[model samples]
Target chain A: MASVVPRKSHNLRYKTLMAWLFTLPGLVVQLVFGWLPVLFAFVVAFQRYYFIKDPEYVGVNNFKEVVADPLVITAFQNTLWFAFLSVGLTFLMPIFVSILLMEMSRRTIRVMMILWFIPVASTAGIAIWKYMYHPNLGLLNGILRGLHLPEQKWLDDPVLAMFSLILPGIILFGPGLIYIAALQNVPEELYEAAELEGASFWRKIWNITLPRLRPIIAMMLLFSVIGSMQVFELPFIMTGGGPGYATTTVVMYIYSLAFGAYNLGKATALAIVLFCAIMIMVGFQRRYFPENIDESSENARS
Target chain B: MPLIPQVGRRRPKTRLMLLAIAIFLWIGVLLHLFPVAWMISASFKPTLEIFNAPFRLIPKEPSAASYKLLASTVNANGQSLNVDVFRYPLHIYLQNSIKISFLTLLCQLPITAMAAYAVSKLHSRRAAKWLFYFFMGTLMIPGQIAIVPRFLLLSHFPWPTRTVPGIPFTDLFFPSWSFIGTYWGIVLPAAFSAFNFLLFKGFFDTLPTELIEAARIDGASELTTLRAIMLPLARPVIAVTGYFTFTGAWNDFLGPWIILMSEQQKWPLSVALYKLQWALTSWQPSQGAMDPALQTLISSGVGYNALMALAVVESIPIFIAFLIFREQLMKGIQIAGLKG
Candidate 1:
């Protein structure tokens, strides 16, 4: 006696159709909000125009003007310098702090990690470092006075102003958390193996820990560079782009042009240029540092 | 399995030093909290007591006078219009912020999550891989370049509601460039973020493949499977993204500053706080009957207090949510970081 068997062939065609349908929303968003506008920004860079008026094709004048203007030149140079110094400081501080944090017992490390993360969660604009920089009544100045040293107008002098802007953010670094996370992810066997080989704490860090952390170090460097280049609110609030444009950043420049002066075309042009510059530099960095330098050759020298 | 365990006891001195370091970290935390505490303490003080001879860590006489000022009314059109003459009515702004944030989240999160899932989980292996690459590639494009065109598009939007041809209500709705100071202007641009989509995709990829296979064998439709199974499973990641989105909207100042006129009544608290100082210092508060020194100090202190209050109020929701979902939030963050 033969039984009537059920025929069931799962059709994946329905899944394919459903998948496309599901992706439609994101496609629309990226098309409208991302790609289209970015394309227009590139087009705007080749033209000289304002928001209300028609754009006139000026092929490279905007770039030439950007390069020729002394202020723009200074901004570019200052941006690079700021990026280098700030990224170095941020990248190095975290690695050192993370190593220190790793040396702690598990219970203590959790507490330290939690404390390190609180400031990162808080609003960047609300921190009152500018107020604390007040010459007469400020905390820093008060300390200087206590030591019988003359007070300085922290926000007034051009040479010291940019450093002042960076000073407040130094203590606000959240790299400790990232470094801790990276350190925790390292395999315990490697440490045990190193210990069996008579590796000291510092030697373990140099030989294994730092090498393992190289990728994260690279990531932190890239982010710090981008972040410092885009610094806006802190300096904007503190100095208002002054003691005479000493600390005016690329983003601040675009802001003043577009919103302050109503030159949307030029602003868009500048923005596109900055974006390209960042991409090229970052691409170069990634290409040059393809394999992270994680070898253990220099363990004894340091 | 235990991830780590003692291979023998550590030395006592190393243990003591670690304890000391932990204490130092707590002290560092106290330092970080100092400004925030000052901001809170300043908000409770009366206007006259702001620059009191010595700084008040704990307010000598705490009052809700500032918050009251933010909610009080001024006479207009022969009646009170609930205008805040000194401080902006932050409570109203807070409501608008909540409405926009929730609307944006409700509309965007499921849609983006679905898209991300489709790209990552619901396709032939090759198709999914290529789609993932394309989506990730978009992250290379910075947001600044898109500002001008986006603004132009928003400003020149055709009217949503229209009238019948040759009717009395011909002007009911015409092509209009009048969204500058409206809620839609803020919501439309901010609703779809790539970062959230990528985050969700990362979460979805880590999920076991067996669940999908089980549902498929059960003859559940793809959409049904997504709705009934995937969405519920993605809760922790969704929650983190939702909180971040809400806070981003609440704290966004640049968008409003660009689109809104100074006197627009519907601006968010961030914009209101910024404009508050600009309005006061426009003609220099020290120019008139007030003594220059006192006027400057008072104006600065007032501005500072308003900013502090706004920041604290805006941050409370995110902090509470984070505390509630602490464990899952950390896990979600780790997933996102690894993918990044």
Candidate 2:
């Protein structure tokens, strides 16, 4: 032991050098793509930046413009409304379905998961939905006609447009693969124990199952909230920010500002505002939910 | 054990509950599957028959017309319109998607795994903590904030500003390469993903340190230890991360759209699909709003049916990938600490 002590210190010095060597390529990538791009965002946010012109520092004028724009307000309102709708319509539906799916036989669960897991590329899927929402040639309208129900212009009408956007997710109420994986980790003994005392199904779920699943549920909620705030592609593709401005989300407005009008400074400012808003939401969530990543890994190990 | 006890499953009340659950799940599966079913069937149906009343799942008179159209360079009139955009045919876009996805995986996986391994095992504790955060800090930040800046950087890499930096006393400016129209623009930025970094680190952390130390003591070089010992053990993590990297690269729309928008021949299947959909919507089949150039194409009877066929073509690789990585993906996420 005495003889090995000096060698151990020397070994650590070697390890440190080797570690940096191992890290060199990833370091360059993160610097180029991850860190440097983010650093430029702040620089652009503060300056009257366009690609072709010299950046002139404008001292918060970009932020001032972002705040004063009525469309910015409208985009925020739409984003908040979409967030609320996503919570009500789609959020916990996966957890609830996965719970019930756990009560099914393994064979049925396997078949259901495989079928549900089949991929339709999101752009393709959105286009498929676009075809379905077509006023004259769509299968959705065809179904409405078959049932003798009045056909509504699904995507064209502003009133029902956002609803139409989320309608597929509501119908495609298949259990999430993540939820099923978490549900499988739930201890059956807890349910069995609940049964011995004459607990109902819902009661067993409340008393035993939920607490076991709380960590994962909290994390999924955090992700969905962050994800929903930056909802761009669905609305962008489905309606191109709509017949009017009904579907122009925050990120959609940012896209228009950057790519559409070429006011990249203002666009970056608006994006910074969005970034702060999401960070605040995440702060509150972490405070309340207190997700422990280490604890979940420990549970998995045991 | 199943959450619902097998013993109680025989009881009448339990049986009814089971019945309800079965019906709910089956309906969910079928409802979700209908759009996919329609995508495939619509691809085969004749264009006029696609809009026919009482829409059927299987085309009554199925035809491979769209598939043939997808294969050919010329329109149904056999007039080659190679000068027009969207006239490059499907194979070029498919090839671009495969190329971009392959190159991204080739660059990203090993580069990220090496960083993750260093942070997880090799570095000193204090250094590990800081390096981990330096790499993982982007996890909380949404990537969209940098879209404009990233686009600018790609147009003239390593210089997001209007003018490239010059030496203080010299007239010469730094050399800059434009990545905007190349596959490198997409492939390079994707070489580091903070999300995948989290996944790799989580996986590497769970691996025993003693095994690594033993390998080192046995005179194996750090690279050899990683290549032979750690890599074989890391197959599950590699497969899971590789699957995600491939899918993300395949399905990515905005990146390719921004980078390759001007270079029409470089567009991936995602960008092509979006263009097709946008085109179809703008020129509603044989309508007055249609451009005459597009009107000819629409008149050739390759409208929504051809779009559906393209969509089917785009989704085939992703479905194939899911089949290959189905088990690892589901099992690996639990190790990702999503499990409770």
Candidate 3:
């Protein structure tokens, strides 16, 4: 027993060492790329940094510059409008699409999902949309002309530019992969019971499907808000924030400040501000839609 | 028998509802496919035909002129063709994209799998808890905050500046290497994904500890057990993680854009596409006409067709990837969502 005890302790030490060995490479990567850069965001935000010279600590001057910049206000407004419109327009489409998809036969569902899941690279998708929104040579205008309707500059006009950016999303709406997955978790018996109670399809959906999907919906909402707030590629490619700063998102402004204007310190400071805004938005969402669906159900079951 | 009338009456109504749904879904499928169809068709059309035949679903006269131009370095008239639209030949950008994405996957898979294995299987409960937090803490912070710092880090690799503070003879630091204009700058930072780490750990947690214990009792090392047992059972998670990582790396725009901007030869398809589109859009007679030769090419519809062709080229690899991993991907999304 004593001999076994010593060997067991030795094995424990060996396991610990092996564990550390396995974790080392990933730790180094996450630290150097992930954590260190995040820490540097704070440091750089407070300093006047440029590639040509050493960093100089300036007391909130970068933040002051960010505040004074008029373009910053425009960027914030555009971003907020984008977030509100994108979420408002596209959020419920997925939930309803998922519900509608559930009504299809199993084989049909598989076929449709494959058709839906055909991967479109982000840049390629944006490029495709760019062609579609081109005023004179675009398919949309051609369709409009064919219908004997007047053509409008989709991306060239300020009022329609942001809408044009989001129109592709609304037009091409399909079931979100995550929402479909969540919808499948709903027990079949609940629907059957609702049907036996003479509930209509909409009634069953409203009662059984929606409540069950609340947690996932809340999660997707948070993701949508975050994603929409940081939208860079769509506007960056499609509009170049065009016609007149119509689609200049906050992230795009940061990109220009950092890379275009060569002001890294102010960019990082704006990034910090964007981070705080996102956190506050998340906090507000949590207060309104707490993720207690599973816990409350489990408590009821107990 | 009382239920018979109720069932009979509901049958036609149910059929009507289903038929309505079918029609709605078909419309959705058409709307979803319209733009993609246009893109593929436009890629094959000549530049003049692209603008002229906007309503045409299929190109009336399909031409590979855009592709040929993309492949050619000189025109038949013995004049050097300007490749500045894409900044390089099509294949060079394709090669860069493939190299960057593949290298990132090569590094990412093993590192994430091993770390997940350690946390899920090797470490004690308290130790695993702390380690998990250490790894995932960054997930809470918005990635945008780190962009500038990360760019700075890459510009001056191994150190953020030319000299180190408090170190004498800093000028002799030969080990420092700048990754700004290289694929390594794009590849290295993406080698560890916190999201995939969670997926792997969730999968590893489901694995029975007895198999590992039995292997250990049979005198197999931990590494052997991981390689032989865990890896074999983990094919699903591996496929999921691998697909996500591959697609993420492949579709990455901003990373390659900012890092490889100066080095045109290193620009991936995404960045090249952006530059091409920018050049195509920015060139107007009123906008101080950039390079008369390039202006002539743009006016000839070469720019439009080439851009569409490039978009097609960019999408094919990922489309093939999806077709290959369709089942695993669907299952993975479900598992990721549930576990997350």
lDDT of the candidates, in the order given: 0.65, 0.85, 0.84
B99 Cα displacement, candidate 1 (Å): 2.7
Question: How well is each residue in B1-340 modelled by candidate 1, as lDDT tens digits?
Answer: 0112255336675567656755655665666667667667766766556554226667778766666545543222223332233334567766765766677777678777888889878777888887666666556666666777677666655321111123365655334565567777777666567778888888888888789879988988888888899989988788778767766776676676677655456766666655543333333233567644334434434444544565566656556665666666556666666664
- Candidate 3 per-residue lDDT over residues B1-340, each given as its tens digit: 0111234445887678777987898788878887788888888998777766666878899999888877655554655645464336789988988998899999999999999999999999999999899888887778898889888788776665424434566655445667888989988999888989999998898889999999999999999999999998888788889998999999999999888888888888898888878767765455674876675566545767788899999999888888888888877777776766
TM-score of model number 3, chain B: 0.91
DockQ metric for all predictions: 0.37, 0.65, 0.57
Model 2 quality (TM-score): 0.95
- Candidate 1 stretches with Cα past 4 Å from truth are A1-10, A103-107, A119-124, A173-177, A291-302, B1-10, B73-88, B157-179, B261-263, B277-303
A167-242, model 1: which lDDT tens digit per residue? Answer: 7556654345456656667888898887788876668877788777788777766766667776666666667677
lDDT of 2: 0.85
The true-versus-predicted C-alpha distance at residue A90 of model 1, in Å, is 2.7
Summarize candidate 3's per-residue lDDT along A1-302 as a digit string, tens digits: 77999899999999999999999999999999988898878889999887677889997999999999999999999999999999999889978887888777778888888887787888999998888877778888888988999998898889999999898889998988877877777777787677778887778877677878888888888888988999998999999998789899999999999888888899999999999999999999998776778765666579
State the lDDT of candidate 2 residue by residue for B1-340, as single tens digits.
3567888789998899899989998999898888999999999998778766327888888988887787777875678643243578889989999999999999999999999999998988998999888898887788888888888888888898767789679998899989988999999999988888888888888889999989988999999999999999988788888998999999999889888988998999999888877877875444556587667767777778988999999999999999999888766766765412
Among residues 3 or more apart in sequence or in different chains, the pairs in candidate 1 whose N, CA or C atoms overlap within 3 Å are none
Lowest summed lDDT across 10 adjacent residues in model 3 chain A is found at A291-300
Top candidate on lDDT is 2
> Could you tell me which 10 consecutive residues in candidate 2 chain A have the lowest summed lDDT?
A292-301
